[model samples]
Target: MEKKLTKDDLKEIENQLSCPSGSKGIEVAVSMNVKNISMTKASIDLLKIANNDVILEIGHGNCGHLEYLLNQAANIHYIGLEISKTMNQEAILNSNSLGTSMNTSFELYDGEKLPFENNSIDKIFTVNTIYFWKNPNVFLQEISRVLKKNGVCILTFAQKKFMQTLPFVNTKFKLYSTEDIILLVNNTPFSITDTIHKKENIKSKAGDDVDREYTITILKQ
Candidate 1:
């Protein structure tokens, strides 16, 4: 018999979705692995990475995408900032396994401030990480600070309506419509270059395949 999702299971899913710390056990790991595949591909597709660009990924859980990106580009440097120590360690190990450690690095961040210097990064991207940002403006400012002039930032998240369908996405997850995100970015130094909408099939908490709508917002600083 298949196990049904309980309140505890939902809560664990919520925690993993917000910030995957790898402590919730195998179920969370399985969910995150599925999410990583789709979200990483979506974010990377928007990047259009160049051979020598210095790219950064915020809240990169497991850094699987980083390994892929590093392998795709010959001379590009990739940096990852993650808040979860377990995920950070896992990402490091994954990079080592890919033999891309020289081109990739991972660091633990508080999600409020970035460790990069001003105008240091050529490109940046994140997937499913905006909801957990306590102060969006501060984080946006930090992103603007670290990004070089005319650099690009791609942020990917599920649309509000689709996000609302998830029982686990409660008050803890700050759901946003495309308009809301555009308005928020308008207040910053960045301007929206493009927005891509995609529908993907993913597993629900009940282990059922469901369609989810995600939006990738491309911004230029």
Candidate 2:
């Protein structure tokens, strides 16, 4: 039997999920890598990655899938951005260890503003990061600003209904339904080219089996 987590324990889990740090954060990063791999792989496949494509991934925790993304194409340059210093450093270490350092770069960001120049990136994708966006509208415009014309952006997140069931989600997470996200995207510079609905049976943070319903919204300018 497992001990129950207190409110403080849940809060710590929430904080770590938002911006991991310290030794515990490193552990969280690893856990996230394992839990998020399916969504990450789906997002990458939606990218339809091509040769020499410059790809950007937001909130790439530990980026355990960097080698997988690099394997999708030839001459692909992958850039991972995170608000957590621990994730940034851990991703670098993981990339080096995977021998994917040559084609990948990691950076820390303020989470509101992207670091690349306008029209610079060929493809972009983010998994489970939209809930933390300070301003989803402004951030969508920033994504449009950096993404090249016709560039694809894959946004994946579990729906509000599913996310709300999690004990640690709390007020820190701004949950959304599929309708909510489509409406938000309509106001941005990009158009919703595709929305893929996904479901998986995964263990919850507190260690229980649950059905997770998520979405992969593909955006293009």
C-alpha lDDT values of all predictions: 0.83, 0.93
TM-score of each: 0.94, 0.99
State residue 80's C-alpha deviation in candidate 2, in Å: 0.6
Query: What is candidate 1's lDDT per residue for 1-221, written digit by digit as tens?
Result: 67887888888778776766656633465567666577777678678888899999888777656656776666999998988887888888888988888888889988899998999999999888898998997799899999999789998888999988887887679988899999899899989989988898987765767788989999997
Range of the 10 consecutive residues with the lowest summed lDDT in candidate 1: 22-31
| Candidate 2 lDDT | 0.93
- The clash numbers for all candidates, in the given order, read 0, 0
Residues 139-176 of candidate 2 have per-residue lDDT tens digits of 99999999999899999999999999899999789999
Structure candidate 2, residue pairs in collision: none
What does the lDDT read for residue 173 in candidate 1? 93
Highest lDDT, which number? 2
